[model samples]
Structure formats: structure tokens, C-alpha cells
Target: MTQPVSKTSVLAGMTSRALVIAALVVIVAACLPMVLSSYQVGLATEVLIFGVLAMSIDILAGFAGRTSLGHGAIFGVSTYVVVYATGQAGLSPWAGFALGVLAATAVASVFALLAVRTSGVYFPLLTLALGMIVWGVCLRWTQVTGGENGMRADVRPAALMSHSAFYWAVLAGAVVVSFAMWRFVRSPFGLTLRGIRDSESRMRSLGYNVPLHLFIGFTVSGIFAGIAGGLYAMFNNFVSPSTVALAQSVEGVLMMIAGGVGTLFGAFVGAAAIIVLENIVSSYTERWLMVLGITFVLIMIFAPEGIIGKLRAITSRKVR
Candidate 1:
């Protein structure tokens, strides 16, 4: 008879595989700027920033079973704070980055307090309402946010002025954020999150403070999203009301879904696919939105498990 595999051995094998894949990714990212044009490098940077946002979404929507539509608000709050601190307050870039992250964490905390008690559809609805509030604020706050005109600030330091340099910086940040998130999701706390997601009532009966765990998870997600926002602001050197719009939040969720909801690194794959396809499609057509919708429909219909999820399933089967 075949012996049952030990969990420890399985975990060790998975860790080794992950390390190898991470090394390959880093090497590829390092070489990308050397081959791509300036515009392409900028697009790659956006992918990394947006990938981080999607990964944050994964932490909430994937692990915690709490989908947040207000994450755009949390993200945009960071961007606006960074711009205001660096441009209006004339603070250094590093200081502004810190402030931006703090603002995002604060907003996320407020959101968690209001919505963490709810579950299922109500949580998403509450988050959507909160997101709309932020969008309206961005529209009406004429002085600080610059209203519809938005805010512009070049926060890049002298060392990262070149496109390649900026790309490398963003890549490094992405790697760090990804590593931290990977560790978080593998920790015991993360296991509690998954347990909560699987059965909230059961976890509660097990003496877990479900709401508190959710709150902490949301805050952690916000921190990652805020990091992405700070990077994006530095990349674009501008922020507008659209940054806080519902569509932004929707797209982040979509990226998570398309890449494989619970798979952390899938966010990068989905971000790269969507960003590159959007750019390519927009270059040829005026109705890229329709195309994007159709593409989403196709993905849902044909690959419901998402690109990475499907690949993982196939790999597992082949290994068996």
C-alpha cells in the first residue's frame, strides 16, 4: 500500500517551489527595463502598483471572505495625502509616503468599524456606499484635492528620475510587499482568517474574535493598498477624483478574480494581462470598455477558476 504523505513534507516542497519561482520572477523583472521602451517601462510600473492593490483585495475578498468596494477610497486617500504632503506641505518624499500610508490605514479602520459586523452582500454594499462618499469628497473638496482638476505632484527623488531607475524602485517595492503578504497569509493568524472565511459561526464558537480578526485583516490590506497608491502617485505625478471612483475598486477586484482570487502572485499575472490588453485594444478601438466586458464574460464562462487557478489544478493533476 502507498503511504500517506506527511503535511510537513508537502509544506517543505511547496516552499522550495515558491522560492524557485520567486527567484525566476526577480531575474525577469530585473531584465525587463533593459529591453522595453520608456513608455513600456512606465506601463510595467503601473502593473506592479495595481498588482499590489489586487493582492490587497485578495487578503480581504479571498481570505477573509469580506469584499470591499471602498478599497479605492482607501487607496486614493493615500495618493491624495502623498500629493498634498509632498506638494502643498513641501515635505520630503519619504515623509509624504509615511503620511499617505497612515491616511489609508485610518480610512480602512473607519471602514472596518462600520462594515466588519456585516456579512455576505451587506458588507460589499456598505463598502460601496463608503466609497461613494470618498468619491464625492474628492469631487467637492476644491482646495485640498483640487476638486475635479485634481492634484499634481512630482514626488520622485533625484535618484529615481530615469524611467529604468523608477521601474527598478517600483519592482523592489513590489517584491517586498509581495513577500510580506505571502508571509502573512502563511502565518497562524492567516490560518484563522481562512477558518473564519470557511465558517464564521464555527470560528466564533471556537472562541475566535471574528470581527476583530476581520478588522485586523482589513487594516493590513489597507496598508498594502496604501503602499500601492503611494507608488502610483509617484509614477503618474498626479491624482484626480477618478482615482477614488467605484470603477477603480471594481477593476482591482476584477484583477484579483482574473488572476485567481486566493493566489497572491496571480495578481501580477492578471494585472499584466489586463493592463497590456487594455493598452493594445485601446490603440485600435474606441469601444475598449465593451471589449473588456466581453473578455470578462469569456473568462467567467470558460475559466471560472481563473488563469492561475486553472494552471494550478492542471499541475496538481499531472503531479498526481
Candidate 2:
């Protein structure tokens, strides 16, 4: 008879494969600037930023079972804070970064405090309302936000003026954020969050503070979103009301779904797909949104678990 395979050995092999794949991905990312045009490099950087945002959404939607529509508020708040600090207050880029993240944390905390008690459709509705509030503020806060014109701030460090340098900086940030998120989802706290997601009442009966855990998760997710927002602002050297709109939050969630809801690195895959599609499809037709909607519908019908999740399932079946 064939020897029985040990689960530990199987896990070890999977881990080894994952590490190798990760290293290969990094090598490819590092080489993109050499082959791509400046605009394409910028698009790549946008993918990294939006990937982080999508990962943050994964934290809440996949792990915490809380799909927030207010994340755009948190993201926009951070972007505006960074713009204010860097442009209006004349602070250093580092200082703006700190303040921007802090602002996002604060907004997330408030949203969590008010909304975590609700679940299901109510949760999303509450978050949508809260996000609309932020959008209204961005539109009306003319003195600081520049009204509809938006605000511009050069948050890029002098050393990163070149497109290649900025792309590398964003790539480095994406890598660090990815690693941190990976650790987070695998940590004990992360497992607790997942447990709570699976059965909130059961976890509560087991003496877990469900609301507190969700609140913390939401805040942490917001921090990652904030990081993405700051990077986005730096990339465009501008912040506008559009950044904080409901559409922005929806796009982030869409990216999460497209990539694979729970798989952290899958967010990048989704981001790349969406960004590349937008660039390529828009050039050919003005009906890009229609195409995107059709694509999403098709994915929902054919690959509901997402691109990465589908691939994982195929790989597992092959291994079996």
C-alpha cells in the first residue's frame, strides 16, 4: 500500500510553494518599470494602491463578516488629511502620512462604534449613509477641500520624483502591507475574527467579545485603507471629492470579490485585472462601464469564489 501522507508534510509543501510563488511575483514586479512606459508604470502603482484598499475590504467582508460601505469615507478622510498637512500646513511627507493614517483610524473607529451592532443588510445600509456624510463634507468643505476642484499636494519625497522611483516606493509599500495582512489573517486574533464571522453568537457564548473584535478589525482595516489613500494622493498629487464617494467604496469591494474574497494576495490580482481592463477597454469604446458590469455579472455566475479562489480549487483537485 502507498504510505499515508502526513498533514504536516502537506502543509509544509504548500507553504514552500507559496513562498516560491511570492518570490517570483516580487521579481516580476521589480522588473516592470524596465519594460513599461511611464503611464503604464503609474497604472501599476495605482493597482498596488487599490490592491491595498481591496485587501482592507477583504479583512472586513471576508474575515469579520461585515461589509462596509463607509470605507471610502475612511480612505477619503486620510487622503484629505494628507493633502492638508502636506499642502496647507507645509508639513513633511512623513508627518502627513502619520496624520492621514491617524485620521482614517479615527473615522473607522467612529463608524465601527455606531454600526457594528447591526448585521446583514442593515450593516451595509448604515455604512452607506455614513459614507454619504463624508462625501457631502468633501463637496461642501470648500475652504480646505477646494470644493469640486479638489486639492493638490505633492507628498512624494524629492528622491522619488521619477516615475520609476515612485513605482518602486509604492511596490515596497505594497509588499510590506501584503506581509502585514498575511500575518494578521493568520494570527490568533485573526482566527478569532474568523470564528466570530462564522458564528457570532457561538463565539459570544464562548466568552469572546464579538463587538470589540469587530471594532478592532474595522479600525485596522481602515489603517490599511488609509495607507492606500495616502499613496494614491501622492501618486496623483491631488485629492478630490471623487476619492471619497460611494462609487470608490463599491469599486474596492468589487476588486476584493474579483480577486478572491478571503485570499489576501488575490486583491492584487483583482486590482491588476480591473485596472488593466479599464485602460485597455476604455481606449476601444466609450461603453467600458457596460463591459465591466457584464464582466462582473459573468464572474458572479461562473466564478463566484473569485479568480484566485477558483484557481486554488483547481489546484487542490489536481493534487488530490
lDDT of each: 0.87, 0.87
lDDT of 2 at 97: 88
lDDT of 2 at 39: 92
| Winning candidate number (TM-score) | 1
Candidate 2 lDDT over residue span 33-80, tens digit each: 999999999999999999999999999888888888888888889999
Runs off by more than 4 Å, candidate 1: 1-14, 311-320
Which residue pairs come into collision in candidate 2? Answer: none
The TM-score measured for candidate 1 stands at 0.91
* Least well predicted 10-residue stretch by lDDT in candidate 1: 1-10
lDDT of 1 by residue, 136-230 (tens): 99999897899999989888887999999999888888887887787788789999999998999999999999999999999999999999998
True lDDT of residue 9, candidate 1: 30
**Pairs of residues at least 3 apart in sequence or in different chains that clash in candidate 1:** none
Measured on C-alpha atoms, candidate 1 has an lDDT of: 0.87
